[model samples]
Target: MTNLMETLVENREMVQPNHANMLDTAHGGNVMKWMDEVGAMSAMLFSGETCVTARVNQMNFERPIRVGDTAYITAYVYDSGTSSVKVRLITEREDLRTREREKTTESYFVYVAIDEHKEPTTVPDLTVSSEEADRLRREALEGENGNC
Candidate 1:
């Protein structure tokens, strides 16, 4: 079983002008792309197989990340089913000059492992390794009323 704490995945992307909109803020599409990529990494790490996005739960942009900021995205497997892995993605914007960070977005995404034929493949069960990990998993489940 993959432990939630150890299964967490993180990636960073430098926000460029091209990645932003006319408002000089990071585009929503770019943020979604980062979330999807990070979520897929977490799913693959937990499943030990290639995974594709199955569904994206409520993705809300809490704040706008301006261009020239660094986007830090972290994802972890919070729950799992027969072939699906549920991942929670959190995004924060870091001011490179000031070394400050602000949360920008959060979303829950589901990924399904797939075989060469693109058929769904099984994923191992998730295990919570620490109190914090257990709490996070519980909170993620409760966020969706246990639907996740």
Candidate 2:
């Protein structure tokens, strides 16, 4: 079994001019790409196998990440089936100068573990070890009820 905490993955990216859209904010496509990368990492950590993105639940962009701001992307396995892992992903905009941060995007990604032959494989069960892990799991489940 893999603990939910063990599958946690966090990545930081500085929004550069190339990543920005016409409004000088990070492009939605760029953010989605980053989320997918980190989400896959979390799923691989939980399954101990290469994983491919199977589905991406509705993605909500509540705010914009301006250029020069740091984008903090976090992902963790919240649920899993025989071969699929669901990861909760959150993106935050952080101003390094003031150290202020706020969530900007949130979504859930599902991945399936695959073997060398590119066939789906079973994954270990997920375990929540601490209060924080439990809370995260609960939030991931409850958050689905609201508009993503």
Candidate 3:
């Protein structure tokens, strides 16, 4: 069994000019790339095997991440099947100077664990070790129901 908390992954990226669009805001593609990376990491942690993205649930970009801000991305595995892992991903725009942060995007990504032969492999059951993990799992489930 893999603890849900053990699959938690967080990453930060500085939104520099190169990562921005013509409007000087982080491009949607760039944000998606970051989310995918973090989500894969979380899935791999949970599955203890290499994982590849299989599907991405509807993603909503609620706000823009302006250049010079920081993109804080978080991902956690909340559920799993024989080979699939579901991860909740959220991105926040943070102003390092002011230390202000606001949610910018949210999505659910599914990954499939793979063995060395590149075939789908089974994954261990997900376990919650603490109240916080339980709460996060609940929140992810609610968000999947379109509460986000």
Candidate 4:
């Protein structure tokens, strides 16, 4: 088993013009790509196997990250079942000068472990130690149930 915290991953991306939409804000696809890469990294770290995205739950863009802001992303493997690993991903926009941050996006994704033959493989169970990881897991569950 892998501890939830052990599988946690974080990344920061600059919202350059190339990654922004006409509104001078980060594009939805670019945000999703960043989240997907971090989520896959977390899943691979926990599963000890190659992982591929199987499904993405509802994603809500609470706000936009303007160009020149920083896209701060956090992802962790919070649950697993057989070959599947569940990850919670959140993105925040950090001010370029003030250093302030605000949540901009949130979503959950499921990944399937694969073996050399590109076949689905079993994944290890997920474990948590009642730290921030535990709290995030609870939040993800509640969010999934439309209670967050």
Which candidate's lDDT is highest?
A: 3
Residue 55's lDDT within candidate 3 is 95
Q: Tell me, what's the RMSD of every candidate? A: 1.9, 0.9, 0.9, 1.3
What tens-digit string does per-residue lDDT give for candidate 3 at 101-146?
Answer: 9999999999999999999999999999899999999999999888
- 40-121 per-residue lDDT for model 1 (tens digits): 9999999999999999998779899989898999899999999999998889999978989998988889899999899999
Clashing pairs in 2: none
What shift in Å separates residue 145 of candidate 2 from its native position after superposition? Answer: 3.5
- lDDT per residue (tens digit) for residues 1-148 in model 4: 8899899899999999999999999999999999999999999999999999999998889999999999999998878999999888999999869989999999899999999999999998888887787898888788767822
RMSD of 4: 1.3
Query: How far out, in Å, is residue 111 in model 2?
Result: 0.5
What C-alpha lDDT does candidate 1 achieve relative to the native structure? 0.90
Predicted structure 4: lDDT: 0.91
lDDT of 2 at 52: 99
Error in Å for residue 79 of model 4? 0.7
Top candidate on TM-score is 3
Candidate 1, number of clashes:
0
Error of 3 at 75 (Å): 0.4
Off by over 4 Å in 1: 146-148
